[model samples]
Target: MFALYSGSLAEPGDPNPYAGGESLVLPKLWFAGYRRMLRVRIETGPAMQRYRAASRLN
Candidate 1:
């Protein structure tokens, strides 16, 4: 994730290492929310699958 975020995963000699950071810190804040959503999805995925299966049986 860090490599991808830092653009190290891109092809060599890429000009831009990072994007959307002219001066403000808005992108960091947005990334924080995105990480939180991924965490929640991972934590709740099994429970959600179970709920769907049970609902289908009703």
Candidate 2:
């Protein structure tokens, strides 16, 4: 099992509660022979930034 947390702050002065805070839970893979070929990358920085911008527009 894998647990991950990602958060971002829009502004230093402005404290937005809904800025960007997400929790992701990933289950472990029990493959018999595929660990070496499998790869995973988690990059949520850009997505979080976009979300903050959209919120401001609305």
Best by TM-score: 1
Q: State how far residue 47 of model 2 sits from its true place (Å).
A: 0.2
What is candidate 2's lDDT per residue for 1-58, written digit by digit as tens?
2111111212223333332445222211222112322222113366767887899999
- lDDT (10s digit) by residue, model 1, range 1-58: 5523544233333444334557345445445445555566766799888998999999
Quick one: best lDDT, which candidate? 1
**RMSD values, in order shown:** 9.6, 16.3
Q: lDDT of all the models against the reference? A: 0.54, 0.32
Model 2 TM-score is 0.25
Deviation (Å) of 6 in candidate 2: 18
